[model samples]
Target chain A: MKNKLLFSLITFTTLFIMSCKQDLNDLSNETNNASNVKLVGLGIMEISYDMKTIRDYETDFSILSELDLSSVNPSEEKQHVEMVLLESGQLNLTITELNFDKKINIPHEILPDDSPKIMKTEIIGNTANFYDINGKLLGSENIPIPNHRETVDKIKEIGNKFSAEDINKTIATMQGYQFIDNLEEFIRNAPANGVQVLEQGENYVSLRMSFNKIDPRIQGASVLLIDKSINKMVGTRIYDAQDNLVQSVFFGYNKGDVQSLSAIRIEQQTHLPSGSEVKMISISQIENLKFNLNIK
Target chain B: MKNTIFKLVSFFVLFLFAQNILAQRNVAWVHGLDGDAGSWQHYNAIFDAERNINSLRTSYNTDNGITHASNQVKNSMDTFYGSNANNPLNLGIGHSMGGLMIRDVDRLTPSTNKRFGGYVTVTSPNYGAPIANSLMDGSVQNAAANACNKLNDGPLSEIFSLPYGITANLTTNVLCNKFISNDLVQDMIGTPITNYDLRVGSPTIEALKNHTNNSNIPRISIWAQESSPVHWRMFSSSEFNNDQTLVNYVNDAREIYNVFFMLNTSLAMACGVGGFWFPPCWAASALYTYRATQWYKGRSWIDDSENIWNSLIKTTRSEQQTYWAYIWIPCSYPPSLVEEKNPNPNCGQWEWREFTRWVSVNYPSDGLLPKYTQELQNIPTGNRYYVPGANHLEVRNMSNSTLNGQPNDVTKARFNEIFNRPQGDWFRTN
Candidate 1:
């Protein structure tokens, strides 16, 4: 009877050990799956701009107009923006070295100058961490990530299957058509009869493209000046329904094997109610532009 | 064969009993100011549901100083645990001033092998409570005393026909007792010694700061902020509504009296003009004059009623404003993010910007204590849990609907999370 009891105890001990081993194995597999997720590339750029916004409120009475006139002084600031596109379709942006002419005050005891200068986002965690100028972590916030799981899957699939050029195209598309890439597609997709060559130079061609066919609400057209030699858009002008020049963007490119934007200037004019008009002009200079960077 | 079976069953039972004895855990529930062992009756049931855990509801004199109260708690703990009074596995859970008492108990005891394995403070005023400061300054008590005096001697006395005599004394004794019994008034007039110890910058608080929990014992703080407005009873009571209605009726009576006065004045003037030759006209003028004088006197009485009503309304409104300011604050954002006035043309009539500027400040508090005071700097941020919209009492009661943005059971869940307990094992030993 004692021997039989010993055998039962041995069997129970062995089963418990086996179950524990299975749990350890399962934990390791989960860790391995987590390790497979990686950041594919990162884009680093320094943006410095001096923006002046003047708002003029015109009224029938001169006294009323004078009282309503509100304008913001020209403010100069500089920031370093890093865009990290993960292999899991997670895009994170970190802004550092954010300098302003004056300290900006945010509500609830956190002032912009005292707050963390380096702000970064963790895609998988759906959270953002803020660090001071010396890289000491100050705080973290959980941000809502829409379609998180699906985005991760899509990004992993793209990273695994796409070539370097295709990945660059994807990053550029995500950045928007205004930065770089998709120039051929954009030109091809323009209305057949709406595109008209406005001017032609030795190295550049200016084309006027109307967007009436694409969307009826957009009663506007864009005039793009592209460098014919490099097939890169250098400048663009957008007009409103009343044929008023609303926005103008000028892009400067680096002289390198890979065409990259070095500087950009944007000017915008908006008309508000009460006969108010606002004009803003800003110049952003970018540096350290890299493509297909392997980010850890 | 029967002997073998009986011996095996005895051995199994003994092993299980030994396991239970080894796994025994004790949690002492400490109450705050003016509270007793009964204060934890609700939480006692919660902890009782856990296996191998004993709940010790400590009874102490909360009216005295924190040190004295802590001594009482120590005695109770010693009596309950007996030989294991200084057990390192004992846990302490305190609310409000009881938290300070528990800390005092720890401080008085030897540091090595401390009495508490861990400590959890719920809505404890670590840095002291502002209300305590107000009480110590005699402002809250003065307000209550003044209110009581007014109820005894002011317009209320005249209205009830008890004017400066035995009846007035009787009315004062009865009515003032009722006024003093009001929950708000009673809380404001808390015991002096406890209030002094609970005030900010008190010697006890400074001592606690100096001796902070340097031991390796784990500490957790569970604090809440009261986001909801003050209860209606605090500012607008049924008595106030009735008084306002009385004022409106008095104003209506005054208007009627004024009409009669005007009509009587016109008749007196006509009679006086004809009284130069007629005796009946002279009598008629005299009668009209007397009637007008009486109506004017009645109008003056109505004016007195209006004045009293205005005074009461002013006092109540001031109290309401004070209560409102205590729980809420104006927006503190910069001009760029928020404007002083709405700039939208379509909604120019709306005061949305002004409303936001005045009411949008969601400062964290636990009704009685602010977040800053409730959170102990010694405790790590990870260990401190905040439940927004849960007031001081509601946090411990664990019945606040707005606690952690969930209806009922959230407080228990939060407490379980703080204790690192799995579901259905809040106090169970693994």
Candidate 2:
């Protein structure tokens, strides 16, 4: 009787422990309830602004005349206006500073050499005025420079905080950022400073370009560096059996910097949005050139 | 009473013989890079205890590439079972580089009437790892110090001075130079060899690309994928990827055509986020919110390209064009780091803790392999099976082990199906 009772007790203890262990395991799985949750689909949108070239404005600045003037403060001595014009045209502008009011008709003419002449605007005291090359007044406007002293102080503080090296680093990073963010737009609109036929293969034309970087509206002023120093250009362009341009790729490197060559294999695939018709060439690298592909 | 006892003993002996016959599908286990024969002991124990099946372990210093290890696997198998064994051995199971070894053996060995069973590869880097880049140059120092501690013999300087010596062999063995050579095994101890290149057309990479597994042999790929614990790192691109709900139109507008998702179903726990809350959110706030800030943005062009490629490129391939009928088994949990072994026991404990903390801060890896690299896409036969709360090591280690209180042995049922399925019905869905 003693032996039987001892055996029974052992069995009961084992059963109890096993049950407890099972319960604990179930509880743990319950706590980590990732599989139970429904996947929430998310939508992401990207915004990028590309400034028009002088050629763009000269082609048609009629789009500039469509600017909304409702927000302009008539009482303010100086005001700032920023516009992205698709096309340009002539328009009347009036500037009133204290008692003096200046008015002039402005013709939106853009330069072909991709110069900063398109970004020019002048304002003085109560009467702000702009003129053509013939010394004739074209336009005048009254605008308020809000918290002008504070703006000046802020600019001075920034200058103090960032050294020349720091500014250059910031610019370099921004340039890389712009190249990645607006790659297609940059390639389409960018004025190729210099494009030369580097190599002419049997069916392909390799074109090298001295690519120029653009200057956008910095705060309220368009800051364009007028330095015409050239950088070496290198790139490749592939052609098909019919001599049609299949793909083109290029990059500009600063002097003394290491030159790197990259290539992407273009496989035939369907169009993205429509999913109909095969695309002969696909461009995968729009961001950084430093990359690798794992095959097999 | 004596007669009854004798009868029972006879029955038990007969039962053992019968079991041996039934469990004819013996397993030949292969370990990953830098692993020893004892590495798969825990797994072997599981096979013995649960299935009553005996398995042979491949005893090779796993420093050599998969091609070299294939010869070791064949010798080990042949030695364990004589040239003409009455009972046939069929199944092969591998972990990481071990998976490649098995594939190479199967490919090189001519097919016969007595062909083996299919293969199961756990967390194998069939495609190269991006983490390999971190191993190049002096960049290895930038990786987690805890991981570095595992590579060093004594002081860290010893490994640095003589990179290709004992220390380099140990760590270089783990790097799997065939898959990647960019950075991982950066400085070899004493050799003039600075660059280990695994670029296309390189010997090992080219060989790997050329080799393809047979269609008859089925392949089961088990890999881990875990959500990053560094979600609350306020302004980083990682944080932005983690918490899509946190919206700032100004910042959101800049994020183009990308949506990142965590592998596991459970939201990262509040306690996990608590680690970043130190100094009441010093690094966390900056990492999460700051990257989204225009001036401080950190961008990965590779990730950007992946997004565009996934959307634009059609991912369809023919069966004949691909190898490995891969069934991807997903492991959802924090991955395990190195097995604790140090001169000082306390050092091992410290390494584990620090490594765990490091993984929680960085990308969600299988402790050793990243989830992105672990995932294999575009195989026609590829299917997914989800296993939550199981890390890289736990899947192959002892069954009794647990990660975050969830039992690692949950995969036993799947293993049973793979191992004990009726002959020639291994590929059947049921």
How many steric clashes between backbone atoms does each model show?
A: 5, 46
TM-score of chain B of 1: 0.60
Considering summed lDDT, which 10 consecutive residues are worst modelled in model 2 chain B?
Answer: B257-266
List TM-scores for all candidates, in order.
Answer: 0.39, 0.33
Overall lDDT per candidate, in order of appearance: 0.45, 0.31
lDDT of 2 at B174: 29
Per-residue C-alpha lDDT of model 2 across residues A1-296, encoded as one tens digit per residue: 43343233223222211221222112211111121111111101001111110000011111111111100101101111211101111111111111223311111111111111112233222222443333344343332211122212322333454454543433333222212222222222223322233333232222222211111111111011110121111222333334443332222222233222111112222121112222322111111222110110
Residue A89 of model 1, lDDT score: 29
For candidate 2, give the lDDT of residue A89.
11
Candidate 1 residue-wise lDDT, A1-296, digit = tens: 43343333223222211221122112211111121133333312111112111111122222222111111112233444433433342334344444553331212211011112233222233334445456555444332221122223322433454455645652333232232233333334333434566655555556665544322333556565665455544556666568776555555554545445554445554322123445544444445544332321
Docking model 1 quality class: incorrect
Candidate 2: what lDDT?
0.31
Best by DockQ: 2
Residue by residue across B118-217, what tens digits does model 1's lDDT show? 6788888887776666555444443334334433322221122323322233234443243334333354365677777877889998787677746556
